[model samples]
Target: ANTAVKVSIDPAQDGPVINRHIFGQFAEHLGRGVYEGVWVGPDSTIPNTRGIRKDVVGALKALKVPNVRWPGGCFADEYHWRDGIGKPEDRRSRINASWAGRPEPNSFGTHEFFDFIQQIGADAFISANVGSGTVQEAADWLEYLTAQDSSLAKERAANGHPKPYEVAFWGIGNEVWGCGGPFTAEEYVTKLKQFSNFSTNHNKNMPTQQVAVGPDGDGFPEYAEVVMNAWSKRTWAWNIEALSLHRYTRNGWPPNIPATGFNQKQYASVIKETLGMNDFIKTNIAIMDKYDPEKKVGILVDEWGTWYAPTKGTDPGYLEQENSQRDAIIAALNFNIFARHADRVRGANIAQMINVLQAMILTDKEKMVLTPTYHAFRMYVPFQNAVRLKTNYDQGVYKEGDINLPKIDVISARDNQGRIWVAVTNIDPKQSIDVDLSLLGKSIASADGEILKAPTIDAVNSFAKPDVVSPKNLSLKAINGQLKFTIAPQSVSVISVKSQ
Candidate 1:
């Protein structure tokens, strides 16, 4: 058994409202995430809304996904908007070597993305190409997406929709540091300055936010400074709404490969790897504050979550990893991280949404099942519109072999409507943590919670039984003003406190 950690809450130092955008998801044209996952086209027998899967849309909708970043990771830079829009047959077919190395027929393009976003009720944040793409193409896309009653609007009408799809957020390029092209900070900034020149339509009063790939968050502050410096000339806020930061929970392919078939020890290692995202977001936000003092720009974790090896015999580019209880811990921890730092970190869209890396929903032909990570995202729905309250984690320690690592036990909440919520995770896989909970702001409270725990961290649900490792409701009445709670090692526990 591990010792209990105490968490204190203070309302004075409140952070930004956890943007529903922080809970946003990513959908790329790569792998099954787009083709088999989101788009099966209109000809399939499976029920779909004009080619996009209706079941998948309905599943993600229940999760309250606030925004969806589209087109690509590396594919964003290679994506030619011309190849995607207009009549289906009119769209071009190109060899996409970056993601899957297959010939991608632009069957599912910009209009399709907007249609899907509309169906899901999610804001669209499209990533523009800077590699193998141009300023004119980027400009034309912005016009096509945002223009209402002009030549661009006429083009949009000719394709299909007459109404404009207001894409509030935009990413200049993905990983301009690496796959976005190995350019120096100075080199990339020059490119960004040029891209910005074309992406803007000040004459039309078209409001759009452009995000730039930052300083290295493989973990460092230097690269962020280099990328944002080019925009110092903009006195009335950056043309970019969010500065993009792409960091995954783990580095290797099929991260669960080693832990997949192992026991508690390997499970502990895999779960611990998920906790490192806490450091990734915190350190990067600190860098952003130093450079842009007022924080007019937001830290957009556009691409995140675990990048692990594929399931055995699966296509590698598809990034089909086993989504287990450990993945749930990763979701809870990262969501809370975003909640804690909501002030500067406004938007976060996990890498690939479905049937790809760290996906929330997985499917096999028509046999679809939500992963544990999906439930965590759904459970976190309360924190979206909730006020960011000050949380004091009486830090605890989790031991892995000889290493004694400090662990954050709980995140507290005090919503705008006077409701208090605390979401806790015991990332330590070895033993349970008994916490002596207390409240600070207002006295006399009644509470309840739902906890998701399992025997091992790597446990997951297949099509056979989808109930494995899901959250179960718990009693959080805080017996006589004290809440005695035990968060199972390697699991997530959420508590809601209401004042009496």
Candidate 2:
């Protein structure tokens, strides 16, 4: 029997305006993620502007990417900003020990990344190196990018970017518990203060917002306890505005489960695990509340998405995988969870933007293709900067291999343009779910929808068939203030309503 989920939404009752920054992206200096994924030097056959691929720039622009975190995951912790500036030919090449031990040409340095960010009109969220780099190095890097009058300004002009860049978000460090520094919570808290103290705002135009490394969801790491507790003790001097959290649904390490070719049991396991982010956010928020009582610090899930084993013959450090409809469902579920907790959740960056774990776009040489995840993001774009509406739904279960998941996941919001949009995801790969939407006390004259779905759970858009899972127009009508629709199995649907 097809499960039925009921959603009741009240437009008058609104929550926080969903932060547009939550739709942020990450670009790490790993594998082709940097070199071929986004950059393909100016002289190359691939159409590029000053080395960055134009096609990728155009696509990311369409998504209206809010902010981009550059030069890392673990890569930022080990990177030295100086190596990426100056002449591309003169830039030094270093071994990327953090990712697949590949050689980083340093061709795509600070200038190139900022150029790409400018091309797409996205804000910059930089992750500074703290584990191995010195305080002066981190401080100088900030000065070089944001300072108005400094030797660094002349240095920037020497490097080709004459004007000072505006960088508002600064990540103090990344993954301090693991790849970052292996520091104890107490140890990291002290270092966090020390490093943040030096990260000054040179450009008064854009004041920087410092983000401290929080914890990995595994065991809900104790770093949060020590850092938050310490902040409570010394609130006056605390400079951190956010805490970063990273979580991935890899099922198991090393022998990670397959990305595309998988059975429902494997899919169910991944879905169940991805759903665990809700608890992770809640647990961390409780800790944040206890320490700050006022919610002064925001939570940024900076590194997230489904990380699977590399495609068969690929380099292990590349961290590449194929995205499928399952990934689309997972993305929708995660976004919905974030929207529900918009107050404390300020921003999130999908593990990567291209050619990496659960990426939105995939590029081969000059050819680029949008993945199912891309369409999922396109469908949910209206939720950005929109006022989250108060919603309640009667949940139904989607059972597979002893694991039962709530059949329907949803987020409702009213955009600044005076439009109401509802994003709904039916995660069941086998059965379609009928949704009965009641816009309480709010009248709607008509409704239109776009849905991304496929025939099977593992259905994907290959180079040969890029549009296999793109969003399609769906005909919908609101009858007597109620909208009834059937969301396809393993699908994400976005519906927009015009009021009476």
Candidate 3:
């Protein structure tokens, strides 16, 4: 038997205020994502700009990757900011490179990263090393970025740019519960408080926006709650601006370990994790409301995306997984979650921006290609400064025997330009869903859509021949007082309607 679902989007009603920060990117000192991806070293001959890749910079800007987080994931914990500065030849060398145990040269440290973000025109969110790093270290790092005039500011000018990056966002520590030290809530909070105390406007008296590592939901419920609770009690020391959570998608599918070659089962597993995000946000936000009813602290899902095992023989530290049609599905779904919960979920960064988990762009030596996830972000970029329209999903469901998952087939946005755009994703890999839009406030003029459907989930594009799987404009029809369309299964569809 087949079931029907209807998603009634009320474009007139204001849903959630979409924060541009919600659509952010992450850059870790891992794999080819940084070393070979963004920064190929100013000295390299691959066509770069001050150790940063000009092509990568152009691509990220075009995609409007609002904010880019730097330093590390777990690597941030061990990162020594001081070593990254000074002369590149004089920079320190270390083995805490990444999960792959590669050599982490601080060649592309603070100044290099800030320049990259600035050139790309995206806000820089720096995640400082707090594990092996000290409070003085964290504080000084903040000053180095924002402080205007000091021996520290002079050092920055000496390094390169005199005008400070003035970065407002700073993450205390990464996964302190896991690779980051597994510190008790009390301990982490104390450490966080201690770090925040000096790190405040100290270096050059730069204003800072502090983000403390919350208890991550690595199966721990109070992970974020504990961090929030501790922050609530602290004195004028900790200026907690955001609480972060990190979650990665894991699918038990072969050859799909490094995120390549995903079957139906693997796709479903990954889909389940992505779909579960709706509830995850609600639950996590409720916990935040426990200690913070006013929702003062911005809920930051700093690291999120599908994470299978690493690709065989590839750079393991790079976290470079194959992004396919299925991965694009995950991106659209997760983005919908962020849009739906834009209130508490102020900002979110996919695992690792380039060549990382569900990343948008993949680079190889002198060549690079855009991923499906990248397209999805670019497609949904129209919703950036727009107000989300309330969507009432149809009473329809897609189920497989005992498994029935609700379809988020309809998400609408009203841009500042007064254009009404609705993005829909069909989870059914085979059955296309019929959507009827009646409550969208008299949109009887004309309609056009874009469809991103591929032959299989694992399909990808290469630099040798890109554009293997891209979203193409779709035709639409308007009838009666309602607009009607068919969304392809396992595909992402976006439709825009014209009406006064």
Give the higher-TM-score candidate: 1 or 2. 2
Point out where model 3 deviates above 4 Å.
Answer: 1-5, 202-207, 251-258
Per-residue lDDT of model 1, residues 161-263, tens digit only = 8877777777888887778776777787777877876785422343667888785446435567776565556645235556887777664533544425666
Across residues 301-415, which tens digit of lDDT does each residue of candidate 3 receive? 8888878676667765556677788888888888888888887888888877887777788988889899888888888888787789988876356665556765546688888
Lowest lDDT block of 10, candidate 1? 251-260
lDDT of 3 at 456: 74
Winning model by TM-score? 2
Against the hidden reference, what TM-scores do the models get?
Answer: 0.93, 0.98, 0.93
lDDT of each: 0.77, 0.88, 0.78
Model 3 scores what on Cα lDDT? 0.78
Q: What local lDDT score does residue 142 receive in model 3, on the 0 to 100 scale?
A: 76
Off by over 4 Å in 1: 11-13, 201-206, 219-221, 233-238, 252-259
Q: Root-mean-square deviation of each candidate, in angstroms?
A: 2.5, 1.3, 2.5
